[model samples]
Structure formats: structure tokens, C-alpha cells
Target: MTTDFGLKETGYIAPSFAEILDGVEDDYRTRLGDDIALTSNAYLGIFARLMSDASYDLIQQQEQIYYSGFYSTAVNSALDRLAGNISLTRKVDAPSHAEVVITTEGEYLIQAGEKFETEDGLVFDLTEDVITSKQSDGAFQGTGNVECEETGEFTNVPANTITLFANPDEDFISVTNPRPAGGGQDYEDDETFRKRLIMENAARPGPTEPGIKSALMNLNGVKQVGFIDNDKYKTDEYGNPECSVHIYVLGGNDDEIAKTLIDKCAAGITLAGSIVKEAPDATGKLKEVKFDHAQQHNIYVKIDVSINDDWNSDAGVDDIKQAICDEINSLEMGQRVNFTRLYSVTYDVNGVDDATIAIGSTKDKLADQNISIGRSEFAHCDPGDVEVDLIGL
Candidate 1:
């Protein structure tokens, strides 16, 4: 009977031709007193070698076929679909936009497609043309919104940095971004994608907490989401009863979020924040629907680290500070900032031996506990806010 190489037991070893030949020779020796010559020139030796090579090739082919079945993309994709698992795909890029205030010597007509650049070579294009009129100071001023040509986190661009105009003819116009650009993001990574899949699969159908969270998470750039059942809260300005769902979202389009709430929530469910959208009834008349959104509160973090004597000098103290800042920056909205986690990050550093961390204040390290942000609040730690003191011992 032929052995099934693919069905072999765990840790099973396929017998090589050489090993089989040895067994055959041993049987021949026992039966015929070692009369056969096992030289390479002999027919027996040549036949045994050829059979051995064929056996090795057969085993390799069987192994390939066995492993290929497990890793086949088509099979995995089909299985994932059957299990209602979402496949990984590239996330859309979000653009960064800022409002630019254009100042001119006299009444100047700025075209809609006018371009400006930052010192770091990031170009921005005007969304609309503006005719600047003379201001109280006798200088022509008009506000035009600009969007970054390339998308990805332009929130760090400082105010008054956009001074270079692409058109020399518009040299008289002085342009500056009054506020930092925001709403830019990169593609989602594998881990984040997998987590989303898990969340989606686990969510039950309806306007439940998990379902609402899952729906909001499907939107691009949504880092965190919180749902507050405000049945007991004060009534709205319009004198409507306060049985509303207050959605506190971190990172995502406000309009889209509001729409999602309208779709997923039950009819007559009052949404808390003001998100106005036009809806058409069966009569073809357009009616406006207003939903409420939660406000944002920023939470600050403060940390101090101590380094060991054997710390690497090349890995500057600034690196440690930046590392701590990065940890805080990676936190999701409304997530608590655990002091022990910060301590763990400091200890994980190559040179750091110990650390003392405070969320809101420096001297209040022991008394002040982990920061617990409200549903409407998000935790943010500026690099400037993170103060690191390296105590070398």
C-alpha cells in the first residue's frame, strides 16, 4: 500500500531513497549472505539512486500542495465573506484645509485658482476667487479658504507661515493662514483594519451602543466615538424634550456622522448637537433636519523621566521626551491616561530607569490620578506640555 505523504502524522519523517536502499541491502545481506555489489556502476545502485531522487521530488510536491491550500487568497477571501468579515482595503486620504486672509494694497481681484506656498514647500490652492475691498485701515482685505494640494496632517502648520504667493502679479497681496489646517489623515494600517472588522462582526443590529460605535467607526479617520444617552439632561433651546443621543466623536466628517445618526437611529429620536441637513419629503418639498453634536474639551498631560547611568548618550534626552509625547498623542478620545502605562513606556525606553508622571500638573503627581475625560472631551498632549527631567544616577 502506498503511504499518503500529505496525511502523514505530526513529526513524521519521509524515508529517503538512500535509507530505503540501506534497508533493502540489509534484507538482501540477511537472505543471500551479502553477494550483491552496491557500487555506483552496478544496476542495483543506479536504480536505487534514481528511485530516491523521485521519492524526494514527490514529497516536495506533496508538501507544496498541502501548504498552498492553507494560504490561498481566493479561499481565504471566500471564507471571510462567508463569516461576514470585512476584507482589508486602502483607506481614503483626507485633505487639510485652512482659511487664508488675503490683504492687498488696493481693490484686487484674486482668481479662484490662485496658489500659495509655505516655507516647507507645501502648496495650497484657493477654493474661491475673492474681490478684496478697502478695510477700515485703507488696505484691501478678503478672506479665502485654501486646501493643501497634497493630503496628510497639516494641522501643525503655524499661523502667518503662508506668505509666498505663486503668482508674482499678486505680489501686493499678503496671505496668511489665520488658523492651523486640520482634517488630514493617512491610510489605515493592518492592525486598525482588523480591529474594525472585529468590531463590525461583533455589533448587533439596531441603535445600540455597539452598533452606533461600529457605524461611526466605518467612517474614515474616526479614531474614537462615544455615545451619551442624555434623557435626563436639560431640554434643548427649541423647548424640545431632552431625550437625545449625544454623540461625541473624535476624527471624522461632522456632516457624515450626523447623517449616520439619522439613518441608524429610530424615528423621533432627538439628536443633541446642531447638525443641519436638508431632507425632501414625499411631496418633493425640502425640509431641514437638525441633529446635535457633542462639544470637545482638550486634556493636557505632563511627565518627568529619570535615566540610568548606563544610558546611551546618542539617544538624546529629547528622544525620551518625544517618546512620551508620542504615547500621549496616540491615545483615543475620552480614553483615560493611565499613569502606570506612562511609567511602563518610560521603563521600556532603552535608557530610562524610572519615571514620574502627572496628567494635569507637575507637583500634583501623587495626588493627581489618571485623567478621565468626559464623553465630549478628548485627550491631547502637546510636545510643549510634556516636560521631561532626566535624573542621571
Candidate 2:
């Protein structure tokens, strides 16, 4: 419930710089306009009131019971450790309509390398070391834009950018040199040295920086280090499409781990978890795995699908069924096939069970076998998109 505002020292407060002037002078009060004054004073008192009001409205709208959008670093760090690779894809599978998909994230470790071109061709070697550096002022923690002037023993120039010397000992340049933007610098002064120290010691968080809510979700102990935010895409109707943030790790085939995460993500929600296995025969086909629906106490399974729109009868229901069924039937046993559920409710209508045709095994048989389909009701449904939760229980 509390937002952590990173404070380096005990003296840190809300910096009542605004309150300091409250009764000090009416002369300077001209600077505070209606909105600014209201916001500044409100921040000291009724900001919590505003939050309570917004939270109550959010709860009423069914956005979330408790706000779960913000995440913590513990979760992010956990995911970072678990993901060892960084692989991305536009299409995870033919049926997967995810806007962006991350096949793996933390599974691969990246290191510094050099790429050089010669008459023979291009050569790349990972032996080289790559480091990131920044410049700051010793007087304060913040470092504004700095200027550099080289003279006499130094390579003096006018309007030249600063450079950080990779090998300062070889040149007279010490770590004190002020590098221009994206340039390396060498410095000799203690002040500059202190600046370098601060820059070096500062945490260098990639992508989702430290102190920010991590988009990553921890699955078991492994962290799903990568996430895709799909709320920005505008659809054909010139409106943003409904979207979700998918968290995933980027290495190894831990079917058990992946399944566990999917289940957690689908909890108390219509979004179900589906486990996918790598198919040996094709590049995109991943075998759908049926897992135990423990909550429903049934044996769930893969089912065939056929889309029918009498309005689009030009593309008739029988034709759609024949085409889809024929493709499914054409698959060799044990081969990766496009697996879908037969009796899933459409995503367009919330709590409305528009039962579609289902085939394979009966619900009673599936229950006898200890597998069951996930809850079919949904919220904030998107039309025509039959999003089914697949997970290996």
C-alpha cells in the first residue's frame, strides 16, 4: 500500500519547499496559481482523500479488487535471476494473436563483444570488455551538463566533446576527465574522482530501471523477466485494443514451472493457462497439453473448433468446420497441432454463455478422468477472439 520513494538519508522529507513560503510573504504568493496552490496544499493533507475516492470508484468499476498493477523489485529481481536468455518473436504460434511475444528472457546472459570488419569479412569476438560511464559534480549528487577544455599537456580543443579514457594510465588522463555525452573521460582532481565514484556506484538497471514497479511476475522461484504491454495498439476501429501484459522467462523447457505460473496468472480470472510443448516436426507448432482442473475437479483436454457467422455465410459454418476439422484431422498422431477448446464462451459478452459446439470427449467422461475446462465466464470481453486458458496442470 505504501509507495517507496527512494531516500538516501534520514534528512529526506517531502522537501516542504512549498510550505516554507506559506506564511512567509504575500509578495511571493503571486507565483502560486489556483491549480498549483491547490495541488501543493492538497499534497500535504487530502492527497490520501483523493486516493481513497479513486480507489473506491475503481473497485466499483471492477477494474481490480485491490490495485495489483504496480509490482515490486523483489519480484523483478527474482525474474531477472531466473531468465537466462533473451529471445523474442512476433508470432509464438499460428493461433496465438498476442501482439508481442517473448519466448524467453532471463535464460541467456549477454556479455561485451567487438565487431570488426576486415577485407576477409566481418569478425566478432566476445573477449573485449564494455563498460558504461557517466559524469557528475562532486558538490552534489546531481550532475548537470559539463564542459571540457584540453590544453598544454592535454589534447586541448574548443567545443570538443568530453571523452572517458579507457586506458587512463597510458595517457596523462586520470578518471577526472569530463567526457562529453557518450564519450569517455579521464580525471585527476578529487572532485572529479568523487563524481566518477558516484556515477560508478549508481545502480545501472536496464530497461525497467530500479526503484520502479517491475512488470515481471515471479513464477514459483523463477522470474518471468520480460513483459509485453499491448494496451497501445490502435485497432481497425481507431480505438486501443484490449490488452494484457504477458510475463515470461527466456530459457529452458521447464514445463512444470511455466504451467505453475500460467495457473497463478489465471486465478479468479477468465484468462486460463495453457501448456505448450515443442513440436519436433514444425517450427511454430507446439503440442497443447491437457492438465488437471483442480478447482473444478475434472480431467480437461484439447478440443476441436469451428467458427460460424451466418452473416458471413459466404464463409459458411460447415465450410469453416470442414476446413478446421480437416486440418486437425490431417495431423499425424503426436505431432504438434493447433489445439483449441470446443465449448469456450466468446470473449465479447461477459457472463453470457454462448455455448459453441464441442467435440472430443464428454464433460462427464472428462470429470471421471479428473480434468475439466476452466470457468467460461469473462469480464471486459473482446469480440470474436476466443481466448482460452491452456496450462499443463
Summing lDDT over every window of 10 consecutive residues in candidate 1, give the lowest-scoring window. 70-79
Of candidate 2, the 10-residue stretch with the lowest lDDT total is: 93-102
Q: After superposition, how far is residue 57 of candidate 2 from its true place, in Å?
A: 29
Full-model lDDT for every candidate: 0.63, 0.26
lDDT of 1 by residue, 1-393 (tens): 133344556733466556656665565556657787766788876765566577777876665455433323223333334234343343557666667889887888888888888988888889898888888888889988787788765433556787888876643658898645544566655455556665676884347778878877776556677766766567755444577766666665544555566556666776654446565544566544554333344444555666666677777565666666777667766667676677776677786766776666342443347767655666665666666666653
TM-score, predicted candidate 2 vs. hidden true structure: 0.15
Model 2 spans > 4 angstroms off: 1-311, 314-393
RMSD of every prediction: 7.9, 26.7
- Tens-place lDDT per residue, model 2, 1-393, is 232222336521222223323322232234443343333355523443455445445433332212222121112223222222222111111100001011111222223332211122212122323232323422211112221222111122111222232222221222121211111122223332232223223422122322011211121111113333445433313222334333333211234333433333432221112323223213433333322111111112322333333224343333334343444333322233223422232222232223333332333332212222223211111112222321221
Q: Model 1: which residue pairs collide? A: 272-292, 273-291, 273-292, 273-293, 274-292
**Per-prediction tally of clashes:** 5, 41
| Root-mean-square deviation of Cα positions for candidate 1 versus the true structure, in angstroms | 7.9
- C-alpha TM-scores of all predictions: 0.62, 0.15
